[model samples]
Every structure is written in structure tokens, then in C-alpha cells.
Target: MKTMTRPRYRLAIAAVAAATALTACGGGSTGADGGLPSNVSFGGGASGAIYGVLATGMAEIVNTNLQGVNARAEATAGGLQNTRLVRDGELTFGLTDPRVVYPAVRASGEFADEPPAEDLRFVMNGYPSLYQVTALDPNIRSIGDLRGKRVCTAAGIQTAMLGELLTPYGLAVGDLSLSNLEWTECADRMKAGDIDVIGYAGGPGAAVLIQAFAGSPTAHIVGIDPDKATAMSAQFPWWKPSTLPAGTYDGQTAEVPTVEISGGTLVTRADTSEELVHQFLTALESHFDQFSKVHPLASYYSLPGTATNTMSDVLPTHPGAARFYRDKGIPGY
Candidate 1:
């Protein structure tokens, strides 16, 4: 294991720049219903990303099922920016990871410069994004095995989570030659053999991983030790134990142990009227089939108990969403 001399992590400057540029833009105006906006916007994340794709699907579902409500997905930077947008009411709802919003809620991490988003509220849980430690090297089978390897991952939660994942193994991000690049670029570098490992967070069959795998015949997902996976879940409730079943990707024949955090979460401000949130959930549940058809990852939200399976302890559910879940007889609502 060799430690690098330079800093290990770098924030995604491109994403921050994108968020700054879009800050001046605003969503639709409020409708006649108790300050609820007539045109609802969901922060879809960077265009064509999984979260963005799912957000677009959700927008269509709302536009079709809810009367007089115009919903559309807006292409923003990513989760962190989405949280800021939702908190400022620029976006009616934001599809982001639970952990991504925690920083804003507590005014820590990337959001340390901002005020605590006390009004941030969860609308509903979305698909689970598993932390996939993908590597083109077949020998890289565990987290500790990357000590001296070249690594690449996106900024924000992925970088932080990867650091945390390495901590218990007595390694740090600095131990590897790490670079922070967008997922697409990371895949490109993997294809070029510019990096040995590319850690990513997305759905099991995420296209990014597929592309990275296609770059090399030896590309495979490295499994987290089962005991470490359990420890991580117990330590961080948002990181529940999950498995990438065999054949999830080419060359991945054995089930790989991993941890998953559900995101694609739609969150709104607490002040958004109860009626509006309730109506949105009703439409989503009613036309789940149509909504899921928008993207394969969208179907994950249709799973049993999806509505209330959010990070309630961090970002509490909005009254509107809670009421809807209670009416549907969901426990813990």
C-alpha cells in the first residue's frame, strides 16, 4: 500500500459552476391552491443521469394524473445542488440521495457555508443506489486491495462515502492515486486504462458501470466483506446491506456484497401544502406503471414499502406525504 503525496479529494468544480449558473433561474409560479405552485419542477440532476431520467418520468406521471398541475424535470447539477434548489423553493421537489441532503439539513460538509435547511422535507423514497466498487483489474477484489492503485470517482457523496468505506480497513483516500471526474469521464478513463478502480454509486445495472465493464474483459465489481457491510449498515442507517446478484454485469458471476442507499428521493419544502403533496403521491401511486416505464430504475420505487422507506430520521417526511402514507396503512408513517 502506497500513500500519495498530494491531496486525495477534489470537489466537482464543474457541478458547482453549473449550480451557480442556474441559481438565477426559477420554476413555475404558484397556482390557486394555497400557495402551491401551478408549475411544479423536479431537480432531475445532470441531464441523462439516472436521477434526472427518473425525475423526468415522475414529471410525466404528475402531468398526466394530476389535473391543472404542470410538472417538468429540470436539469441541474446533481444531488447537492438539488437540495439547495429544493430548500430555496426553486424546485418544487428534488430527486437526490438521502445522505446528500443530510449535509444541508445539518449545515455541514459541502453545505457548511449555508444555513441549516430546517424546512427540508422528504416526499417519498426512490430507487436504491448501490455503492459499486468497480475495477478493471480482476485482482482488485476488496476495499483494502486498492492501496496503491489508481482510482477515480465523482465528487460529493461518492468521494466521502468511499473515504468512509476505506477507514475501517485502515486505509484512506490518500493511500491511492485518486482523481475526481464525472462518471462518464471516469468510464472513459477506465476504458483508456487511465485508472485501476472506479468507484461509483448507481442502480445495479447502471449504464455507467456497463460502459466501464465494456472497456475491459476483466472489469468486475469488488465485493465488500460481508461483516464490514453489516458494520457499515449498523453504523450508518442509510447504508443498508445490499447485494449485486450474479450476472448483474459481464464477468460478475458471483454475488457481490455491497451497501445501498436509496435516493432518487423526491423532497419538498415543509411549507408546500399538504393537499399538493398528497395529490402528487396519489398520482405517482396510481400511474406507477406508466411512470416506471420512463426508466428501468423508476420501477425500483414501485417496490413494496417504497413510500415510507426514506431517511426519515435525517430529513423528516412532510405532513402531506406522511398523511398519504398513513392513509395507505403504511407502518412508521
Candidate 2:
């Protein structure tokens, strides 16, 4: 008979020991202990997408600040998926858009059973997303001019927000030939002359919008009337008046006023320890410049109560986060 494989048996035993150690350590592998809950996974948008980049930066910040906590970022579809994962405890944190958050909490929408995501608490708010309207027809200089044209507003939360924004202007889906297209599809359709107008809601520096504007020199960004924007804001409390500063995109010299909404919020489960959350916020505040270097958008992350323009939609601040805000006398929930 062949001699027993002593070396192989020893290797097998070592692997088992490692696995058991991981399981015994509160579902987290042994690493630097940051006085945090445990190892955490962050969920954001599609790979290399805006939210994906933001999530990656956040993970880096958290890992650097906390000991023993290995935070990893993962790519997901978008807001809706992120919210669901957080609710199911599949993710410790995530980045989400406000458009998706509102519907998720509403009684008539997909998250009716889940009700208000009471467990969902905000970590940070990102920049404003403008509703950009570009029309091929020279005569279509405003929202009213698209009455009889074929228009494409990318589907999902964006399409819904567009409908809400246009209703008071007496424009409805029936008023225009509508095409349900994604952002990339809408840009291509506009370039191919398949669509007369494209409505997009995104951050000021969306690549697709930049390309669309560059490709179609004749295309114009229809100006939204201030009164109309005000009326819409009255209907949707979350809507805010925002301006895309001059030169945000080529050939756009004058500041363009538009109805906007905040996107990209860092959220955590309600049960996450306050001490851990406090440490995370303190580290973020202390390292603002580091994150800003990582992503220009992160420049907005700072002390909550400062006079600098800041978003107020962060509804129920986490206890740990609230402590930091209160210490600064920043009004927060």
C-alpha cells in the first residue's frame, strides 16, 4: 500500500483552520480592527459609472480611517438596486439617487410593502442633476415647442420626473411621440435623426450629453422658464432651482436655469453602531481634501452646518452622524 499523504493532510487541515477562523470572527475575516461593526461591502452603480467611482472613493476613505475594517466597493445597476440590497442587509452601505428614493417610499410604488426605509440613513449628498432638453428643430426653443415632435427621455426614474416636470406646462406623453430609450440609445437616436428631441437628467458633466451636444452643432438646450420651474417645485418639494454655470458644456455660455434634484447619497443601515458611524464621519471631515483629490465632486463633503450651499433632504440623520452635526450646531434630523 502507498504511504499515507501526510503533507496533503496537513495542508487540508490548515485550510480548514483559516475558514473556521473567518467564521468565528463575527462574519469578518481577520484584518485591521477599526472599532467598526465588521467587514463591510458598499454597493453603487454600473462599473466605471459615476456612482461606482464615488463608492470606490468612499471605501478607500473608510478603510484608511478605521482599523481592521476591510471595506470593499461593488458595482450594481443603480439606485433601486442599491436600496434593495441595503434593505435586505446584502450591503452595509450604498449610493442612491433621490428620484429612486421617493418612489421606493411611496405607498403606490414598488416598495409599498417595505414602507419607508426607516433603516436607510444618509451619509452624504452629491451634486445636483439637471434636466437637459436638446431639440433638433430650431423652432423648438422651449418646453412648449416639443408638442408635436418625437422626443426621447430615458426610461425609469428620469422619464417619470420628466412627466412630472411637464404636466403643468400642459404637455403629456400623448402630446409628443415618445420613445423609451436609455441614455446611450437616446444620444445615438438623436444623432441618427430618429428622434427630434432628447431629455436627459444627469450631473453637469455627463459624457453622453457632452458628445450629443458636440455632435449636433445645430442642437439647442431649450431654456426652462423660471415660473414653470417654480410651479413644478411647488408640486415636488424635492425639486430645486439650479443653474448650470456658463461654459459647463461647449457653446453654452450663459447660465441656464433648470429644475434640478440631488443625486448620489451615501446610506447606511439604521442598526450600524453610532460610534462607528461617528468615527467614519469624523475621518471624512478631517480628510475632505484627500477625497476631493480622488473625485472633484467630493469637494462638497465638509462640515454640515457651514453657510456654503448644501442639500437639506437628508431626512433622519444617523445617531452617530447626528452627534457630529450637533456638535457643530448644524440643524439635522
lDDT by residue (1-333, candidate 2, tens digit) is 111111345434643553343233332212244346657767766567777787788778889988877777766666777777665566777777666666555534667777676567666667667888877678887897878788887656766777877876998766778887667777887888888888888787677677778756677678788988888887776677777777877777788878787777767677766777777778878887887776666665666522122333434566777776777677534
* lDDT (C-alpha, whole model) for all candidates: 0.78, 0.69
How many steric overlaps does candidate 2 have? 5
How many clashing residue pairs are found in candidate 1?
0
Best by lDDT: 1
Q: Please list all clashing residue pairs in model 1, or write none if there are none.
A: none
Q: What residue runs in model 1 are displaced by over 4 Å at the alpha carbon?
A: 1-36, 215-217, 234-237
| Over 4 Å off, model 2 | 1-35, 303-314, 328-333
Top of the candidates by TM-score: 1
What C-alpha root-mean-square deviation, in Å, does candidate 1 show against the real structure? 3.8
